[model samples]
Target chain A: MSGAFEIYRRWLRDRRRSTIVWSVSIAAVSVVTAAFFSSLGQSLGENAESGSTTSSMLGLSDGIDPQTPTGFLWAANYSNQLPWLMMALAIALGTAAIAGDEADGTLEYVLSKPVTRSAIAMARAAGMVTILFISAIVNLVAVAITAPLFDLYDSVTITGADGSTSTASGLTFGQLVVGGLAAFAVALGSGAIAYLLGAASGRKGWAMGGASGFAVAGYVLYTLSNVTGDLEFLTWISPWRWFIDDAMMVNGLTWDILWPFALTVVAVVAGWQLFLRRDLQN
Target chain B: MTVIEAQGLTKKWGDFAAVDDLDLAVGEGECYAFLGRNGAGKSTTARMFLDFLRPTSGSVKVLGGSGADPEVRSRIGYLPGDLNLPPTMTGIEAVHYFGSIGHEPDTAKVQALMDRLGLTADRPFHQLSTGSRRKVGLVLAFMNDPDLLILDEPTSGLDPVLQDTFRDMVIEHKQRGATVWLTSHVMSDVDRVADRVGLIDQGKLAQQLSMDELRTKSTGNITLTFPDAPDVSSFDGVEGVSNVQVADRQLSIHVDGPVTAVLARAAELGAVDIQTEKNDLEDIFLDTYSHEAGR
Candidate 1:
């Protein structure tokens, strides 16, 4: 096998157990969230159609109609909740890919090979990205399967705020899949950031702690920047804000996506370069 | 034809010099043993050879390529002094992983080596005993059939039978015209297999000698029991003999060279029976190190 593929294979074999666990957990969360939103949307739709006063269906301030598919509710809620779940999973898996090997002394054996050190880092990062992609797909599938149950239970047509109405049968599965995949790209970017931190630190605890703290810190800074508008420069430094703004799951792609994607590339490349240049402890 | 050449190799950690001004050459098809005490820079030298540890000064060239170059690294097999195998991997997996790194070994070659070395593929590395783990390491080192082999304390945890088997493996590699450089404090191990030995003391090469030359330099001992009280004092001044002790008709003399002259002298003194023995490698090694330290 080529060196790149060999490294990728090794990474996959090493992380097979963790990857399975992450996929299952993410899929479970997606299922549970999909179920909860479907029931909530149905109850609110019944209240709206019966001419009784109730909160707007799907938790929106706008009115609900009986014609639209329940898939819209699933997509809206998933787009809001899934990013955090995906971020946590990506960080956990990416942290282990590089730092775990260093802690276990396998780094020496791997680096002793004929392949360059940079290739090792790049291949491992690629493996983590692959894992993130798999988890995202599982999450999307869960949402797609569970969202239609809400439409059956509510007996209501889902309508957009502009008074346009569509039945559950009218929903485009392809659009939902594309939208889900775009959000997954954000998870991939987060995985790269986590991998960079892991390689730089060479300690799993430190890498995980630092990545989590960075994510939380970035979120807080982005919120503050949004509230104060004048500190807009701070949003550029926050990966979470950049990912959310770029994927535009709530609305659509924004201009801010460009900076975060660029930063993600820089972080990943820097991490790989550090791993190549530093002497392996083992 | 030098297979490994290290010139003015110096490695220092902060103010401490781990390896200092070292120059070594190992010829093709030769088994060269590096002998040193614990913390005497033997492992440091080995690491520098593989470019695992960067030298503070100087260079190491393997097969005419720089030590750090992938081309050179692929042609050399190294068994690190501290054998740290990944606990999660099986013995076979570990070998396969290294084999992938150093030009993948053919399945037939790996199978043959595992069988010869008595390594089981089913056992996880953490489950293996120390001797078994060493066998795992041995398989990795020899499986690739590289042009140069650098082994550190290669026989530390082996049983006598396995050690003998390992000696045969080294010989087999030599027969294939590969150069082997191994480091060990066990003198007899070098005596059994090494063609030439380099003795290092305190981060410096104190002496380099062939096995035959080493045997010649160290004095041998002879114990003689005279049939009668034949005044063995007459044999004391003879050349090639010293440290003569005579008590109750038993005479012991330290012989430095061939005993032909000493035996003839003993015959003249009416010796009835005499036995001669050579000094062991351990004693010779200790004496050599002590003598060098004293100098």
Candidate 2:
């Protein structure tokens, strides 16, 4: 379509400033936290205990030793702070892609052009992906370049609670990449829900609120279930359960990473189709 | 050829009708003015023609094709009642972006329009004043010189001078065989641009008139005064006159069709003072609706 490329290109151009700000700001947190990880010294092991709210905040999974380089990197940055903020960025992009324009009447004006609604929907989705991918790349680069400087790439030996010792491996590039990809996946999945809501109802506030609520509710459910061990069965539905289960930085490339990618495909198709059948709000 | 057509077109939200059973056709090279008060369904009907809102139980065609067809849309320029673009978009970006997406708009023409409307490219759309935004809309609508133009309240925020300028542009477009379907309550603007007028009330079209017919029906209020109180019954059954109300020394009379006959009648009744009130949208609506009731 004649207008589709221009719309997509224009959307990306419009998103450039925000994407840079969000990516840099989030990566700054990751790097700053990673830089301070060495300062914590032996306190890392005490912070890694599971089954508490504090443990949930650190995204501590069972059997992981935060005193180790891989565990500290996972617990300190990639597990909670990185994925959570990245999810926010993705949600923003997804909601802005369709519902934001529609609410403000830009989508209506664009429809007056010689482009199909499908073209606009597809272009917006593509634009969202482009900006999100850029954000993920910047975050990965920031973490990768700063990892060794913070001793995240060095192997460490931790004394067990039983007084036995074992050597822990350093964080590899492959594991780092997997960690970044997993975070990106979780963020994209949250964003897809936002996209679906925005497209289904051309209301920006609703989309943003619903998607944010979904993310917060999922995390809360997972955290509460982890502590109580009562609603453990319910934790299956939350993305946080799978994300924290594998903690890809600690355990590289698990099948649970497949959840978000699948949901993203469904969201793109459903959002686009739903948007086509709706009225453009003035 | 008919450039725009709507057959039994209707739009309803639940049970509340925004537009009801409207059948309309605008020929090529003609200017059709759709006149209505706020919430009278002018915008809703226009939206249906552009496929922004689907009709409940009718069909609409633009240039002999569905508005959903890109090819049909490519030959049209539309300006919404409330023009909104991306807030961060400057007028230059809007012109380039909107200009390119459809037909290859004439660059020279676009420049001329911007100059004529005094629209600048420095400010983003949200930062611009309402009038400035309307200017951007006018430029976009005219830049393409499309086969059909559907403008909703196109001159609401424009100053009188710019409104006149807009009328000139619409006339020019009509001269070039572009069909224009515009909705405006500004009679002066509509009087200059519309070849025909359709009056709508409460979502149903009450009347449609050609410019010639409307000119003939241009009714007004003529206030006449005599030294003493005039008898209201004295002016009864007067030709081209109605609604004669005598208050103290004044006789407020409504003159329809021709004022000449009423003037002659007033002179015989010893009127000392006379005043004429020109017709506005409300008067037009009353006149048209009354005629409909009579029919």
Candidate 3:
């Protein structure tokens, strides 16, 4: 319907300035973070021993040296800062997609028109996705063009503690894109939870806080499970399990990356249905 | 044809019912004012008519169709009691955005409504005062020339002049065959626009009466003053007059309807002056609420 299209246009236009600022900020952080790689590489190489606590925190697998170009890139930005920032952005957008507007009374006024709630749901959901995509693209392109400046594409030769030297591959452009998608997937799935909570409750604080708590629980589950391995059973609920376990930036694309995407679909459908069934909040 | 109809419509949250078992029908080309005190389920009923809040039981139909129907809603204009748009959005932007959605508003009509209301359309919603915000809302609700207008406290924040303007706009809409359903505490608005007033007290319709019926019911008291102490007995047993009392040179009698017979008696007594107390809507509104609350 043309009405639905216009609603979507207005939704995005309302958030366009924030989206642009978020994208540019992420790019700036990415470039600035990458610029310090060489300066920190040697110390991290000497101190960040394989299988250490630092590796687990950086989301690196056992024996992946933090000083390697691919390892440092994954450990420093992709696995932590970038995904966390993007996920925060996604969660905010998703929560605002319904509950935020409802609380502010804009959604109720919009619903007063000839546009169906389903149309508003679909249009706002699409707007959230567009913001995520644009932010991810900007983040990926920022790292891609500037990775060379930071020597991230140069291979690293490491002398193991056993006195044997081995060559680890440099970070590739394809891996950078894969890592970006992986981060996007995690953010999308988390955002879906935020959207679901917001849509079902129509309370901005409830949705935003509940979604944040869920993300935190997932993060703790994934990180603690990796270190202990005894809590592996609970890690299934945490999206961080797939994201950090694969560390797509280091391991290349894996089947595990699809898990967040799948979770997103399920959460979004559930949210939309609940939204359709309930009363619009005042 | 009834432009809006509700049959035993009710809304309950858990055990508390906001609106209960209400049956009402507002005909086309009429202004129906839904009046109540705060938290009396006025806004809740309005929301149900717009389908923003679903009825817990029974049915509410607008324009002979479901309120949930987009086509039905297209012909409806709505303004909430507490109007809030995005803080960053200016009134002009709000009009453009909401207009772009469904039923693209006529630009000339929009300008006319804005000009008439004296709304500062370029100011963001947050920058405007309460009355200014209400002016923007009035323009939007009237801009579409909708078949039905559901306004909740439409003149709450409006100044006296703008309140009059809003009443005029509502009258114009009614003259054009557009039905109006509004809730207001402002008696002037009720007096100017409402053809019929439905007093909803604690989610129930306590009374429904037309403006003429209300005026007829307003016959509170007629005080006859004379140069000398008037004969209270003379006014007794007069038609449509009761509670006759004499104090000094005045005879005060309560008249429920016409005072022709009572006045004739007073004329015969050569009453020098006369005073009539016409009860306004506030008394009736308070009576309805207190009556229902005491019950």
Off by over 4 Å in 3: A45-47, A50-52, B291-295
> In terms of lDDT, which candidate is strongest?
3
Every model's DockQ: 0.32, 0.66, 0.80
Worst 10 residues of 2 chain A by lDDT: A41-50
> Chain B, model 2, TM-score against the native?
0.86
TM-score of each: 0.80, 0.91, 0.96
User: Per-residue lDDT tens digits of candidate 2, residues B191-281?
Assistant: 8888998988879988998988877878788898899998888777788787878889988988877788777877897789999997854
Candidate 2 chain B has its poorest 10 consecutive residues by lDDT at: B280-289
User: Per-residue lDDT for A216-277 in model 1, tens only?
Assistant: 78776665555456577766666656454433433445665455456567878888877755
Error of 3 at B29 (Å): 0.4
Clashing residue pairs, backbone N/CA/C < 3 A, model 2: none
TM-score head-to-head 1 vs 3, winner: 3
Q: What DockQ score does model 3 reach against the true complex?
A: 0.80
**Over the stretch B194-250, how does candidate 3's per-residue lDDT look in tens digits?**
999999888888899999999888778888889998666886677788888999998
Count clashes in each candidate, considering only residues at least 3 apart in sequence or on different chains. Answer: 7, 0, 0
Global local distance difference test of model 3: 0.87
Model 3, residue B177: displacement in angstroms? Answer: 0.5
lDDT of each: 0.72, 0.86, 0.87
Which stretches in model 1 have alpha-carbon errors above 4 Å?
Answer: A38-81, A151-187, A197-206, A223-235, A244-247, A258-260, B82-104, B220-222, B227-248, B251-268, B271-278, B284-295
Q: How much is B281 displaced in model 2, in angstroms?
A: 5.7
